[model samples]
Target: MSRTGIATGPNALRGIVMMCLGMACLAINDAFAKYLTDVYSPVQILFLRNLIALPFAVIIAVRLGGWDAMRTRRPGLHLLRGTLWLAAATLFFTGLRYLGLAEATVLIFAAPVIITGISALFLGETVGWRRWSAVLVGLVGVIVVVRPGGDAFQAASLFPLATAFLYAILMISSRWVPAEESLWTTMVFQVLAAGALAGLASLWFWTPVALSDLWLFIGIALAGTLGMTLITEAFRFSEAAVVAPFDYTALIWATLLGYLIWNETPDAMTWLGAAIIIGSGIFIILREARPG
Candidate 1:
């Protein structure tokens, strides 16, 4: 970061690249999970996804500095985060079962806006009026996409809304963890938390996944891990406000992949909602970047 607290020069470019690649990786992970939702419970899929990702996360933790860098004083917070993660994943996958990739992603894209509102209301963060207005505008965009009583409406739309809310809560909860806490420890614990919870849920809803689909689960795991790592690196390299706008690139990936693989295309209203939400996000970034 430069003296102005923004990523400058090559650091800015690196952050942009990391954030863009991270969004693409996450999109790929979601696509793989969407494909599997056709034949498996979200819990079952989440269980395997966590299981597959665990060893790699542990390996990364170990390599981050062999046991020392993997320590955390906040196990309870990590478990809470993991539970939120598990819920968000299961709800999102459930939404995917009925909604197109772009539509679902657009709704989930409200997470950051929700996070700001949460911080101001509950965390005592001094969010100004401009950011609050953007949150409302972003919510209107969400309502347009959801279309409550319209023929396009479905109960499944609530899943992503819930996901955005839960995700915001998850992010806010992270603030409670001490700054000295190891991210690797948080990462590993959350995965284990999801694994433990999902494993229990699987006992009741387990469905046998075929040998053919095993590869898809592994792909989900790998893509998700790559996304998480890149996103972490992105924040390390640049200011959150500087790189956050780039995260919107996930919509493009979701739309393209949905059309190519599943023959799904979002309508004009979806695009309109997406544009509104994205514009609000950009505005929030601009507001935050302005020096107080």
Candidate 2:
């Protein structure tokens, strides 16, 4: 997902397909993460994943262009993004330990709606009445999904919702980041910074992983780089308002993977809530895309 510029040519359409593929890969990654957690510490998993992924991120950046192209005016912003992303990953993974993958993911999607408000108040981006209404409606849909304070609510479900604001803030900063900064540089910084921190944290309770788990780490690295690139390209070529709704693709993939791999079937209430959230999200995107 090269964020060089708004992609053009036949490749633009291809980006959309790649984006979907990326979502599928991400679903696979999450499934694998959940499986590994059963046998390994989540901190161990996070540390190794970043260490394995750092080289790939650097290589991708170099392949995209030289190290010189990776230069950024705001290393601070990238550092901040890396730190928050670590928190987001750790929190979401912890939530996954207790919540269904699809459910946690749906909650994270709340970031888009959060971004809308952030853009309006902080970035001074104009919000038309339609988008404002969409934001409100999107919140209603999230409420339908979470149903907080009720016995039906899953307490662990709130973790992703809490972490999502961090993810949203990271993404918002990414938008303002210097365009010249190679995606690879940003990615490299992310992996290295987070890996180092997680490694330090894991020192208190490091568990030895089996050889086969090391192989899984390799796969995690590659899948993460590819998924991140594809998703970045997706946003570059397509409007965020248009492309965001397609994120529901992850839920379908997650649900299928969860059922087959983990034997965890989402209940009827889960399905209904997901449908409301996804359907309303797509509707919001469509309304925003309409020509005014």
Candidate 3:
């Protein structure tokens, strides 16, 4: 019923499946990126990711509607979105350098909670006490995960925390963009700008990727592009509220992959914090889903 022609009717099963699969793909992509970080800078890794993804983005735009699909008088929105995304990815990847995969993922998963808090503080949106309490609980969850003064905590934890904040702002600003703008248009802008920006930053840190590691780069590109497309499809098939909750499935993927690949086993506190964050996020999602 919306301008984007997304079906938000009673049938949400498709959306749920797409959302879960999308999270899985993204988790796989992150695993690839994490593996590469040992030998490559985050900037270098992301610059190459954007470079590899650019062709796919262009092909998607062309297939969707050729040049017409990419037409947007308001280029600023797309530019800003892309820039924010680049910064977010950079910070997140850097965080992975020091944090375990599941730990880093749990922190970023607080984005929904951050979005709610940001709306109240900056957008002048009215948030009832119940929602406000949930937001507070979410922040507490973040603190528990960060454990700033604890032996287990690292300063790098702030990277993902900041990623969550930037991502929240990115999501909010995206609302200013008209629905008439094609998704591929936004994607192309993201790939181009992120690549260019990261490429510039990578000048000091760039390393030649060996042929043996070329497969990892390709894997990162494929999983990332696919994850982005599938998540988009998830939204198109169902209402935001319907599929949003399933985003937490990324944690499951991250935890399992972390154990199998990196031998990561999160402490009980990490799981506890993740549960609190996930619960608060679900509370916000459910509140938003009410019929109003």
- Models 1 onward score TM values of 0.95, 0.88, 0.94
For all predictions, the C-alpha RMSD in Å is 1.7, 3.9, 3.2
Candidate 1, residues 247-274: lDDT per residue as tens digits?
Answer: 9999999999999999999999999999
What are the clash counts of all predictions, listed in order? 0, 3, 0
> Any idea how many clashes model 2 has?
3
Worst 10 residues of 1 by lDDT: 1-10
C-alpha local distance difference test of each model? 0.90, 0.77, 0.88
State the lDDT of candidate 3 residue by residue for 117-196, as single tens digits: 88999899988898999999998998898898889878999999999999999889878877877777778887888888
Tens-place lDDT per residue, model 2, 1-292, is: 3343323456556666777888988887787777777776667788888888887777777776687745677867767887888888888888889887887887877777787778898999888887787778767767877888878798888788878788889878888777777666677777777888789888986888898788887777677778887787787677665456667799888888888876877777677766766765676666655555
- How much lDDT does candidate 3 score? 0.88
Worst 10 residues of 2 by lDDT: 1-10
Candidates by TM-score, descending order? 1, 3, 2
